[model samples]
Target: MAERSTADLALTLTRASRTPLPVQVADGIRALIMSGALAPGDALPSTRFLAQRLSVSRGTIVAAFDQLISEGALLASQGRPTTVHPSLPAHLLQQVSAAAPDPTAASTRRPASPGASTAAAPGRPDPVPAPAPASAPAVDLRPGLPRTTRIGDAAWRSAWRRAAAAPEAETGGLTGLPDLRAGIAEHLRLMRGLPTDPAALLVTAGSRDGLELILHALAATRGTLSIGVETPGYPGLRRVPQVLGHRIVPLGVDGNGLRVDALPTGAAAPDAVIVTPSHQYPLGGSLSLDRRLALLEWARNEDALIIEDDFNSELRYTGAPLPPLSAIDPHGRTVLLGTFSRLLSPDLAVGFVRPTGAALLAELRDVREVLGVRVSATTQHAVAHLLADGTVRRHTRTERLRLGRRREALLAAMLDVPGVRVLPMHGGSDAVIRFDTAGSHRGRAGADPEARAVAACADAGITVGRLSAAWGAESQAAPVDPSPAAAVGGVGGAGIVLGLARPADGAFSAMLPRLASALATVHHTR
Candidate 1:
């Protein structure tokens, strides 16, 4: 039981492997525990010290620990030092022995034919369609994406000009050129009704990066995390916590938003929660004031941190932009993430996360410094100008009206189509359509993944997404149910996202009728 930091302890855990750093770290630790190189009751290293020694993000270290915990290989105590759980070895043995043989596995060595393994018939809806070629897009009706085709020549040139002219940011001040943060702060203040202090703003490469940064800060001070998420939420939201080793508790959502009453009570609930209150991702339901108050109460009681990722606040076709959850967070628990990707363009990749306050921001800033820089000051500056000149803001407003019209067009077009059922979202870019026959896109083998099923739709030049990954599974331990085709309306859907903002305007034209026809086909047969 040495007093050394986690980094020093990780020295004993290093192995040369092609696996991800997080996985390798987990494997190394797994080997030590399995071999009894580290004894029960022995203390594990601190995450920071280990990350410092291994030269990886604390997030990466957290991911390692998350995996071990998931496999019943490690246990962590809150606020106290991490230790080797007494029964870890015995449990690890049980886990190792109980693993099912994957016939699809590259190294399928089991005696039984892998195909013979019937996964106790998936009780969930029949699995959905196959994946569309990432590059193949005729009329992209895929949802959750934004139109970025309006970055005018004048604004584009000006942004580049500012970026070209701005000097490297000083080593001491918060990221980006001086004017960029100022511009963004002012814009958020005026447009979003957010009183953002320039000093508190830290620009990031993207909203995803911003999430990573906030989660990194939260993980360092806690152990055994449970972060809350919506039931039918963005799959991408779960990745950050899963990677950080936090258990995601599925919070039910209705007309309002995340049901605060469903949050785990006592000391067992999550230390943080990520939400899209402005407009719930995928579901598109905005959190009402009552729910917001309830969420704030839960956060106060649970002492939880709220991560507000408000990407599409500006694109609301209906109603005023509600006050961000972060703005009303009295305890400074909310960390707001604002991204230019959807508002301006996906390629902009500029995002700013306002931390709880200066103190937390400083701690996170140090963490970023330790990771050898996670963002670019240059792009940050360019985005700052876009906000200052009203180019990004004006374009976002204009696009909101445009997307609003398109939403109506797509909705109206699909009104008469058969078998295609879309749940209406109050305001969002994509639709979620439930298809009758499970399409071939679901890579899940147990379900009927016959190519003929997918070809039936493909022949009509329509594409769709399999719902397994998009929707929640029974548990984090379980993959999404592989049944009844759920042709996702986002990214890859039969109804194409129809982004008039892309370089490819002709793509949507081809997709519209096919979507209408597919709907008609599904309805007529029904």
Candidate 2:
């Protein structure tokens, strides 16, 4: 056979179609084989070369090849490029060619009458009708969720297979599987630039579980400690300390994240401060260098600890990511909370807590021993494999590209809408759309434009985040212009938060127009 480049195989991809890329590629190849464009025994291009030529992930090409191989259309060996099955019967190819319908002719065909017979001709097998396309699921614009369809790729299955085959460990232990802990440590060092000892890392179900464990450990030793949380912050994190009977201090936040200068001093200082410095929740602001330094200084002077929720910092679309708070802390007073919920899938329920201080680490270990391990041994093993084989990093890169495009689509859709502004951010899974109500009667009456926006989105079958939910009870109660022109805590004005991670690429694009229309309606209303 003559040598042929992958360019010989002409494949067109429809980016706007709801069909997944891998399936599209596979179907394209199958059609080529059935049509005799690729003859039996013909060699195909390497997956790496094909992936680059097609501008898709390598895993996508691998999946397409795997699908074809399973159906006896392609053959692959350990070290050779894939090829069309040499032993494929010529009669089978002819049959497939004869059965394939002409799309153009089908498009122009008239519908049969109600009384028309639908049976195949005598001595012919009846053709099976194609299944109807499934309706798209509801669009969820609430933050923190990610596109999970990509997680079920070959790497994911392979990870689980390895885990199932491995000998079951005697125990997951107080801190989780040793191999998983080591994997997490290396991950943090490479991704977040935070050097961590495997011993200092404790695996938890997620950020919430890690926070609960920390609170319990601290309460057991120090009694009811005051936990400082960012106002208009993650309600889930705030609720953890509140439910544990600890005092919740509402800290002020600006565009640069938490206001370190405004931190209470003397008798009112908090015992620990929980913050999302990488990308502030709801607002999507990075903590300034000056504030980071001041926060560390405040923690030292007050003898407090910093619980850093390094949330969604890795999904940044533009610019370099700032170093995590734990990476720069000088006093060893920071406890870093990391999770795969946003990077991978929330269903994985895997996260890690790493403290810089020796005493704090020891205390957390002791507390975990009493509480026992919350994650299953199999889960830990699977996650450890993902981390070890670079699957997590590759997946993160793919997701970042996907989310960046979604963010751009959102910004473009909302750009022309009157009285709406999309906040600027380096990276995050969600965007804040501020509704401008300046000089309007609703603005003067404290009409809560954010609430109205949320209602409008809900009515359109889209669930979105409300900025008001981020505020503490007291902040929500304070009298002020609910719809101000200036950004509040850097988030600016009343707006709805849209999660960019939940929808499929095609569904997300389709959703943009509806979202814009809903927000426009809310803006023009009295």
By TM-score, who's the top model here? 2
lDDT of 2 by residue, 1-526 (tens): 5432221344557778899989998987787676555667767778886687577899998999998898888888778678888777565477444422222221111122121111111111112222322443467777766775866579999999988877875346888888899888767655554446788799999999999887776666557777788876777787778766677777877666777877888867777889998788878877777788889889878777789998887776564345677766656777888888767878888999988666677778888888888888888899999988878866776777787787788889988999898887668888888776765566455366776677677667688877766776534322232233224633224667778887877878877887898889877776
Candidate 1, residues 223-260, lDDT tens digits: the string is 44567766556676666677666567666554355556
Q: What TM-score number comes out for model 1? A: 0.65
lDDT of 1 at 106: 28
Evaluate residue 188 in candidate 1 and report its C-alpha lDDT on the 0 to 100 scale.
66
Candidate 2, residue 324: lDDT: 75
